[model samples]
Target: MPLSREKIAATAIRLADAHGLDGLSLRKIAKELGVGPMRLYDYVTNRSELLDLMVDVVYARIADVGQHSEWRSTVLTIAQATREAALEHEWFADLLGGRPHLGPHALAVGEANAAALSEAPAVRGIDDLQRALGALNAFIIGAVRREVTERRTARSAGTDEAAFQASLGPYLTGMLKTGRYPTIARLVIDGAHLNAEETFNHNLALVLDGITSRPRT
Candidate 1:
């Protein structure tokens, strides 16, 4: 059977999800697909192009942001969907925002997000809507990246976040006793919410509140 770009991208996504981005390569993908490594070039020019395709394929999975009735809902939905995708594909958080993904699906998602914001009563013009979208994207990507990174670190350490933090307790105690970082020390001593989902939702709500509360200029 002949290979198509979509098939190539899909296979790459699976490989990435299974082995992580660092473990993914054309050679491995071709081996998994039962094809020659050189044959992949017929579809994607190189690794960079293949990476771009994978990013788009992942972005395509996000439900249309404009489908929601309200801008706030749409933004929240998109943010949640993005976080879900990143969690499902651990490599996704790293690749996101690393490059411009101008693929069809990516562009469509962008359009949907912008359109949803444009319809918001608070958004006065194209500029405001664009800024709102940008701010939302920035927050989602940053938050998810941190979440994914911590998860990955915990996995590597052969424990969950709470256990990992517990392992660091001695060092943290010493550092806190110095009183060099009072706020961080307070958070550590007072205990903070370690639940990724709750943290994401809480921060997302704060971001949305900021966006909506901004006075229309």
Candidate 2:
């Protein structure tokens, strides 16, 4: 019997999550598995190959849509999956921007999104689908980046976002009381209902507003 690719990928993911991608190496993975460095190459040829496999391993978790029956739902689900991918490996976003067109995970995600968006009623041509996919990917990637960075920052500072924001909420409330920034105050006071889901929805709808608004033949 041979070492399973799943076992090798898991070791790499665990190592990347713990030490960041910068420190991830074949030797490190082998050390984690209690095997020689040469043993890893039997499953994956090199670090590049290992990265591709690792990416697909993460992407394999995404839900395969039968169709884009609900565009909003698909986008939101993918967005949430993006966040999950980033959180699963702290170094994911760090590796994301640079490893395009090469990693298995990277291409798998693109294929998934392209297939989903291509089925949308609003998509008219290949060009339309391509542009929409580009915009959607950009919007989602930005959302995940913002979330993971903020969460990492908050955690490193010994607090989570809610507690940190709560400390400032009172100050914001006082500013509202004195009317220093009346419009902002009003929004803040009323925006207390704004949670993560709501915020993401607001941004998602805003982006898709253009898509939904496009002249349909």
Best by TM-score: 1
Model 1 per-residue lDDT tens digits across residues 20-131: 9899999999998999999999989989999989888888888553467776787778778889999999898998887888988888888778887787666788788878
Per-residue CA lDDT of candidate 2, range 52-131, in tens?
Answer: 78776776665442225576566667767666667676667665555664445556657666776766667889988888
Name the weakest run of 10 consecutive residues (lDDT summed) in model 1. 63-72
Q: Distance (Å) between predicted and true CA of 89, model 2?
A: 3.4
Ten contiguous residues with the weakest lDDT in model 2: 60-69
Error of 1 at 63 (Å): 3.0
TM-score of each: 0.92, 0.76
What overall lDDT goes with each candidate model? 0.85, 0.73
Query: Who wins the lDDT comparison?
Result: 1
lDDT (C-alpha) at residue 17 in model 2? 85
